[model samples]
Target: MTYSGAVTVGGPAEVHELADLMISKAAVGPMNNNAYLLRCRTTDEQLLIDAANEPRTLLALIGDDGIKSVVTTHRHGDHWQALAEVVEATGATTYAGRHDAEGIPVPTDVLVDDGDTIKVGRVELTVRHLVGHTPGSIALIYDDPHGHPHVFTGDCLFPGGPGRTTRPEHFESLMSGLEAKVFVLPDETWIYPGHGNDTTLGAERPHLGEWHERGW
Candidate 1:
């Protein structure tokens, strides 16, 4: 189930310039969240990222192969609102950070925390907690032994922005999360952001200081 060949993202090809372009930007609200299907290009087993507003999109992506699990990044309506329906439709096990576990509309079979590992096919995502946007903002990184790391950054990092921090106390938490959890990783990780365009760990490294100075 290792996705060896090129994993073509099914979305706008203009992403080479933008930071991320996987999720449909136009589909927002009750229909706007970005849910991803992490499938082995060579197998039927798959892991679902955040469920979109249209739970049917999550449903349509399924086949006899079956959805193994549904992992939510946080409690934002945009991230997990359709989760209840997805769970009902697929019987998929759910995973979320402990802080936001209660917010998951579906029953969570497993509760994850920072440094946790969840595998789908050959992809083993090491979950990290970056909780400024919410109480349990989480990020997942697919660590390929030799290939580039693929980071599932819910709302933590953006093409030209990072997750927002509205309060002074939360600012340190955000910075610490970025510095300890995100910045500590190799510079080659490919960022798959929750909102807009995609970027790389290298591309975003320079803006850390500015983001901190701006104060959330």
Candidate 2:
């Protein structure tokens, strides 16, 4: 399957080839939340991100791949609507940001913290705790051996601006995390968000100043 192709019943809506790993994406539910399945080519181990919605659809995408773990980006309802069902079906270990773990439906087996490394087969993903979108919002970074970083930025960072924040303090937290953990990375970094299309750090970096001015 070609990269960036949609993964549906017949195929993946979006497919990304990263070194030894492949990422498949599908948008589900009324919220149009993006659910991602990451597979390790060498080990055949799979890690699923945000079981969003539609248990049947997710299970179909997962097929017999055998999900090793399910990682929830945040406690948002839209992001984990099918978590309980997915876990029951797959018996996969559940992980969530330590601060938001309590809020998610299924009890998180592991509470991830910033700077922690999440193992997917032999691959290692660095975790970054991004606040504002949610106190426990977190993003995972995978440095592909081929170059370019692949980051899954839950609801914290998106294409046009940061995730929705109701207060100035929340916005500040989001901006600070972006500046420190996200924007500081190379422009080639590929971003996979919770919903909609994919974007690169290079494509969004130039507009950071504009985003700040708009106060979104």
Candidate 3:
């Protein structure tokens, strides 16, 4: 089946296969958080993005292969509800944004910043810090040599608009970051968000101005 990127709590995950990577996306927790498991095809090395919730479900998806690292996109409780448990079970190194590391109860083995590179086998992901939804919200980018770029945006972005922000300044900051960093990519870039369905930059690029005007 084609990957639609739509998932529900308790539902089976959707898998998207690339030339060198296999991505499995599962929705967990009452908040319906999306957790992504990325595995390298060449080396079988794996990395997980957002432990989210439902430790059993996450572990089941992980199976016995285990992961090398678990990256928390932000400090939000919903995003890392199962962080400690998952890390304990898998013994994976924990990574989180530098500014928000202190907010997470679990110790961060690696404090990542914008432009940092994280490796899963031979595949490398560039970290993009998008502030607004959280002080240290980040998105991971995988530039496929044979295809379009893929981005795992935490709560920083969604299909309809940017993630929720409490203040006008925050909204502006998020908009600026998206334009300067994310939107600059080609329109074919696929966006896998922290929640809900996926979208392409082309589909959302037209609405950037509208999102800013609405101030969400």
Candidate 4:
């Protein structure tokens, strides 16, 4: 089941830019996981998020740019299929939610919690520990200087609604976390999910009540 639009070399076509930070994304692997390469325009330091799969493809995206860190958004297997390889090749520090640290294949160098800040060159990404998608699902929020706040929502939040959950309690937890932390932000916030196209807080805002009522 090969997915189309697999980006290999000089790929990850530019997705968006925030201040001096440039975001590039590539759809890779059978699962079509989105691997993002975030580069700091000022210092050239980069941070690759999700290292999801296709090590060779991800390596091409990294190119000669030095990666300062690789952050796994959650404990899901699909999200870290190439983590070990990427880490070995780049020697970048690995970060994950402390609770989900044991689930990832690679050793986590840094355990981040809510409110923690991760530095990519001069930019700082605030960590939001959103649970439900996984016990320790987290999202990284970057306040774009030229635009709205950009959030990397691993699988917690999506375009239509919150991520998939089996139990009602998990759904409630996810909704509450988003309400308290994410939904309160400006409506212009751009949402980059774990897979597929991106959305905005404003775009999904109107459906919050619908999601709650539907019990998804």
lDDT of 2 by residue, 1-216 (tens): 566533343334577777799888888868878898999988989999999988888998888877999999999899988999999989999989999998897999999999998888988899999989899999999988878889999998888989999888899889999999988889999889987778899989999899788888
lDDT for each residue of candidate 3 in 1-216, tens digit (9 for 90 to 100): 899999889999999999999999999979999999999999999999999999999999999999999999999999999998999999999999998899999999999999999999999999999888889989999999989999999998899999999999999999999998899999999999999899999999999888977889
Please write out the lDDT profile of model 1 over residues 19-121, one tens digit for every residue: 2212112223443344567765444467888875666555766546668898899877678777888888888899988998887677778899989998876
Q: List, in order, the clash count of every candidate structure.
A: 8, 9, 0, 0
Q: What lDDT would candidate 3 get against the real structure? A: 0.94
Root-mean-square deviation (CA) per prediction: 5.5, 1.7, 0.6, 3.8
Best-first order by TM-score: 3, 2, 4, 1
Error of 3 at 61 (Å): 0.4
Model 4 regions lying over 4 Å from their true place = 1-12
Leading candidate by lDDT:
3
* Candidate 1, residue 31: lDDT: 32
The regions of model 1 sitting more than 4 angstroms off are 1-32, 41-43
Best by TM-score: 3
Please give the range of 10 consecutive residues that has the lowest summed lDDT in model 2: 4-13
Candidate 3 off by > 4 Å: none
lDDT of each: 0.70, 0.88, 0.94, 0.88
